[model samples]
Target chain A: MADRPPVRDWATDFDHTDPTWVADPYPIWDELRQACPVAHSDRYGGAWLPTRHADVAAIAYDTDDFTSRSVVVTEYRPPNLAPRGIAPPITSDPPFHQGARRMLLPLMSPQVIAKWEPSTREYCQSLVHELAGREVVDAATEYAQHIPVRVIARMLGFPEDDADRFRGFVHHVLEDVTLPLELRLPGMQELFEYLRDQVKDHIDNPRDDLTTALLNADMGGEVADLSHVGGTIALLLLAGIDTTWSAIGASIWHLASHPEDRDRLVKEPDLLPTAVEEFLRAYAPVTMARLVKHDMDWHGCPMKEDDWILLSFPAANRDPEFFVDPDEVIIDRTDNRHAAFGLGIHRCAGSHLARMELRVALEVFLDAFPVFHLDDPAAVKWSAGQVRGPRTLPVHIG
Target chain B: MVKIAIDSERCEGHGRCYSLAPKLVEPDDLGNGRVIGDGTVPADQEDNARQAEGNCPERAVLLEET
Candidate 1:
């Protein structure tokens, strides 16, 4: 066999099996990004890394050249996912992809997202208020975790009571990386069944929510069928809930660590918008993967078909070439153009909704508890892989 | 002075501009484009408005010199 690319020992130890890497993989990320910006790994069975910011951004936007098929990490790839992998619409190349995006675009219009802002703000305030006067509280469990799931539940026309249930299901899918295939398959089935039933209910009643919208959405003069609805819901749940939770938690962690930035925002409340952008750039919560559609050269590397290319959003956000002093959390950093929400066709559909939730969450929390501080930084925990964020952020609010 | 205006017809309702520059742009109750602050175009916010235009995924926002 030809010489294999050097694999990091940590990749073998942690790869997809180890739970330790989920806790805090930044050190490993730094090492990989520095040592091999385009390194391949044996543990992942020939997965290519694009650690630099520009490379990741280029690959993410170049859906025509570097397709989104098989976007899931090797660790998270399910057998059934392959059939739908990189297919038309979401995973497909342009022309069709453009139309698909357009079809779904109306559902996430600013007005629709803005209507949910009140609910999002109320939820965030309640979570923060519940933890008030307490020395320690799990910020992730109480705050970050609630926003996206709750918003999604409302959008999907599911009862607010189902938020915890759906959150549990999503958590199982994301965290249970090491579970047997048999066990893992059931989780997907359970979530699919739940969503399927939810869609059926919408079809029967036909409310004015997102489920209803999707069910009625005409894709070339035909309503979205079960599979399309199911896939869209799954995509929204995964993208809307988990990614937002990670970003909210990560933002809190960054604010806690950088008291100066936090204090500055609190002092000048007008800077909250800029502060939001800075937080997104400073701690992007998602790492993306795309499959090379056909054999094409990328940066002197012969990226072949089906080659899994990873996009490091956080790394790209911090690239000095893109942002000056990218490491610093300058709340009012002008000329900030980070790919936190990504770019091009596959750019997040729910980004506007996500931003509304984030901005409102930050605004409410800062206004409500300007003097809050972390009870213990060490108590905060993190999870990695496709989604990265604090597991628990303990804080004291007076 | 330069100001940004969102084309409601071509907006596609993506909301990228609103997210990028919420201070100057907001959606109505139905999520249609609505300029914040009576379209005055605050002096300090010109840059944000321009950035929103440049970053708009749909190119729905238009900047006009006054």
Candidate 2:
């Protein structure tokens, strides 16, 4: 992470990487929603943060005004890579977006994702089993972090032991966005190199996994190109890891702190599904970004072409206008039309897979511990960037 | 009596409708919501149908009273 000045005013100068925003951003977002619904910053070369659900949704849906050329706010603005940007679908726009997205949607749909549940559950159970006799456990590292890495690795047919390298890739792409182009570009290059190697391996072996599926994926009667395959693989690997990892870690962190929710869930196991949704709504892990297509007045904020729009679904989920008692985490709360996964075209392709991982991880953890709490409240450290969650979560299970 | 319909144009496959009311709606190959069996909601399952309609983030789920 790069060092920078602390945020003076969240409304005028909001930096997502700022310690104030990273530590506890809900209050900052709450204040911004009322005072400045769309906050602007000179950091990251003129970025705008839209705190309202309507604004964020409008931006997400308006493919015409905001381009998905680059979803990450970094010093280096990726050259116009629309339709099939650095990562397809997630970074693609309009007609091109739908096709690229459709190719992968079936692979992640509920029915398809359902088949992985058994394996995911087994993996989670094994993780829990490892921590059986431990009095204190780092859920983030030991339990929550490993689940997604293992699952995604198996799906991609990559070496499962290379989890550390994947985390390094995640940190560079997501957490280290504030770094200079010289530093950031190399990390991205390394990631692509890794994907290329994996793609080569899949080609040689032709195994049953996402890499093979993507390589052989049809693009309107034409096979997807090499770069597209590698990019899509990059998307699957990078997107799948930290986002779900954060969701699982945050959910466990919540349970560790809030025994009431934990006990309720432990007693009535059926409530886990609803509670999972609630956790996603309240502590939604992913916040996406978009680049302004043309200079235009956006809700009184003078936005320039190529200005970064932090399309914060997290902020949108907490918008009082959209959610009842927006800040409160009600386990069984229905009518939760939250934009946790996002809205419109670019809804997380791996949402079903993520949901499965989260539900299973929580289920295994609660079943193993039954009763747990934060070992040290002050010790929990949240990762600073778009994907926010506790990186180091210490809990006492005994 | 009520019948359910999903606007394909609006449905982005969030799976909320199908998740909430599986009997009334189900996900297609692409995970978009599809009304099951003539899209009709039984008297007993009307609440589930309505819940699905209201909870759809895209507002794609439609319930028509007949």
Candidate 3:
């Protein structure tokens, strides 16, 4: 983790990587939403956080004002690689983003995701089987973490045994935000090198996986080159894993802590879908960033060119202006228009997959062990930085 | 009778409408919500269709009376 100064005031000197914010950001965001909806921070080279749903949604939809060239706020800003930024679609702007995203949308559609459900459920059951006899299970590491890693690994045609390596790469990109460029560059380099090797393997021996599909993907009659293929692969691997993992881990953490919710879920299995949406609404794991296109006044804040906008869907989901009792978790909340999967053009491509995984993972776990609680609430450590969730969750299954 | 419609321009494919009202809406090839049977909401499914319209984050799902 980057050793930086602690936040003195959330409105002016807010840092998402700050210890206070990472520990639990709901309180910080709630405070900011009431006091300052658009909080500015000098850190990360002049970053802005829009805590309200309207502001975040406006930024997400306004492609002319903000560029998606770099969604992650790091020390080194990516050079203008518009149309096909560092990672196409997610990092690409407007006209190009749609085409780049369209290539992968069908692959992660509800129907495609449904096909993976049976296997995903089987995988979850196997994981539960492995942790059955254990009295104390670190659900985050033992179960939740492994689920998405395995699923994405299979999709990318990468060796599933390299799950730990993927986690290391994900940590470097998402969590290690405060690290200096020189230090952070190597981990990112290693990830690309690994991806290159996998692409090479797929080229040598074509298979029916996403990697192969990308290599042979057609972009408006033109085939994607190695760099485009590799960048898309990088996006899929990084974006797909940690986000869903956090959702699953956070849901498990919620159940472990709240016996009533857990009991209700166990008794009314049909309520899992509704409960899953509520969990997503309350504990949205992903917070995307965008760079300002030019100098402009946004909601009274004078934002400059290249300024980072920390578009927080989680904060928006909890805004009192949008939701009733935003802080409280209502498992049966039906009228939920939460932006957990985000809104506007850049809605999460893998949302359906993430939802399916969360539902299946929870269903399998609850069925296996209906009675479970936190082993040590103090021991639950959340990941620092943009994607927040319990990294080390100790649950007492027995 | 009530009818449901999804404006493609506004539907970013959150699929909330389809998830909340499966009988009334379904996701297309790209996962954007599409109304079932010319979007004519059965009398029995009016409540669900309305629920979906209210729950859409984009407010893309429109409830029309025929």
Question: Number of clashing residue pairs in every model?
Answer: 2, 0, 0
Residue A87 lDDT, candidate 3, scale 0-100: 79
Worst 10 residues of 2 chain B by lDDT: B49-58
**Interface root-mean-square deviation (Å) of every model:** 4.6, 0.8, 0.8
Report lDDT (CA) for all predictions: 0.70, 0.90, 0.91
Q: Give all TM-scores, in the order shown.
A: 0.84, 0.98, 0.98
Every candidate's DockQ is 0.21, 0.81, 0.84
Per-residue lDDT over A224-282 for candidate 1, one digit per residue giving the tens place of the 0 to 100 score: 55776677777777677778888888877777677787788889988887778778878
Candidates 1 and 3 compared by TM-score, better number: 3
DockQ, 0 to 1 scale, candidate 2: 0.81
Error of 1 at A41 (Å): 1.1
Candidate 1 positional error at A163, Å: 1.7
Which tens-of-lDDT digit does each residue in B17-59 have in candidate 2?
A: 9988999888999999988889878899988888898778888
Question: What would you estimate as the lDDT of candidate 3?
Answer: 0.91
Please state the error at residue A295 of candidate 1 in Å: 4.0
Candidate 2 residues lying further than 4 Å off, grouped into runs, are none
Q: Supply candidate 2's per-residue lDDT for A267.
A: 98
lDDT by residue for model 2 (A202-270), tens: 888997888898888777777789988788889989998999999999999999999999999999999
